[model samples]
Target chain A: MIELNDYLILSGLLFTIGLVGVLRRKNLLMLFFATEVMLNAANIAFAATSHYYNDLSGQMFAFFIIAVAASEVAVGLGLLIVLYKRHGTLDLDNLASMKG
Target chain B: MYEQIAFYLFSVLIIGLFLVTVLTKNVLYSMTSLAAGMVLIAGIFFTLGADFLGVVQLIVYVGAIMALYAFAMMFFDVTKDVKENNTNGSLIFLLGGLTALMFVIIMSAPIMSENIQALYPPMAGVTNPQAVGMVLFTKYLVPFEVAAVMLLVAMIAGIILAGKKMDQSLTTEDDVIVEIDILEEDEK
Candidate 1:
């Protein structure tokens, strides 16, 4: 049967994939996408635990996390756009001299 | 039996998207696929019975974050991403090995013996959302407000950065002239 351990295992794999993207992709935008993968992995685990205990707290925490993630996207996208217009690209290797 | 089957199916879906998010060449496409993976995770949440989070995951993640990704992508001239697409397969294996090691380290920690670690049965009425809302609004209100405030700041910052582009680009006529001249000369 679909067990909690299975969900955790799946999330673990997904989280590792995100970590791989974050570690390997030199493109700033891809890094952002990877970060989203990681966030979703956390959400999955949160929901799973909440379901296991039949408690609302985990769900509530997930709710808050969702709200914050949305805001993070809004801001992160804006910064990315600015970087693109100014630098004409989104490679992380090229952005090291930023924030001056 | 059905639960086991569902677990395997969800696991494949999640893991497949996990790889896609890392391997796709196009950033926007990867982001969309990530959204798909998130919705599937939300389904997993539903399976777990966290209805509130499942719905919130849809509204906030797929709805909001994916849209923002699309918006950011629209601003870029993606053709300028000229580097050859390359990935280190050996590094991927290394990362995988490290993760497995870390997982083993975490899951094997000797907390109490299984007999001692087993908990009493949960209380009869502890499953509702109201109890959580009460705790959040009462005990965790401060951090909650801080998160909200952080969102507000992020929104303002995004708008400012996006808006500043017009002023800077328009005002920098001298910088554009030389670049325009070079482009025109090359076209001839």
Candidate 2:
């Protein structure tokens, strides 16, 4: 079994990769995937820490996070669909038209 | 020894698929990779002794939400979105450096160094899945109900909004095409 500290390190690395993806990727869908990566990284950390602490609350919180992620994807993708129909594309550069 | 080997294997799959999720130009493929990443994360949760969460993650994430994403992709007719891919440049390197600095700071945290043995002590033998279900259904019944309601609302909204696109795409294609042909004939 891997140590909890090692798990934390893994979580941290995953989150950073996710952050990089979110920052660098211009495609909204890719960014959404990146966000999922970050959320899962946090979820892993939460569950691991809870395991280390012997508390049920962490796992419970992770459940809540999972619920929220599900809801977000549902709504967010719905919006993305609308955006695609309007803009004809998903590039962030083109998304600027909505700003001004 | 077995644990280490398993950890390495899973880690390779986790990180490799994660990069694939980020790098793949195809949105559908990206979503698939994301689903795979979620499943592997659930496995991580299992290894961490969070059995309830691990199963929930798999069910909710890989099963439900990934399907939802795929369906939305189909509904949207995302033919244009795939064409305008942006190449990520220095952002990855910069974010890597920043996160490294963060890791250094996090690793050096006094609280971490203080050794919270009081935290998760190893209960390597017990199965607590039933215990969590009991708590979720009994103690947290109200919140659970509310969450179910929230999920219903979100689900309904997603259906309604996505439904609009299908309706629009068909109607606009039919109506607009007829209107354009008539306008062109009238002009001539």
Off by over 4 Å in 2: A98-100, B76-88, B96-126, B138-142, B165-188
Categorize the docking of model 1: acceptable
Per-residue CA lDDT of model 2 for A1-100, tens digit only, reads 6777777777777887788788778878888889999888888777877777776666776887888888888888888888888887777888776685
TM-score of each: 0.78, 0.80
- Docking band of candidate 2: medium
Q: Per-residue lDDT tens digits of candidate 1, residues A1-100?
A: 5656666667677777887777778788888888888777777766675565554555556767777777777777888887887888777767778666
Pull out the clashing pairs in model 1.
A1-B3, A1-B4, A2-B3, A2-B4
Which candidate comes out best when scored by TM-score?
A: 2
Off by over 4 Å in 1: A97-100, B79-87, B107-132, B165-188
Q: What fraction of the true interface contacts does model 2 reproduce?
A: 0.60
What interface RMSD does candidate 2 have?
3.0
Q: How many backbone clashes does candidate 2 have?
A: 5
Candidate models: Cα lDDT each:
0.71, 0.76
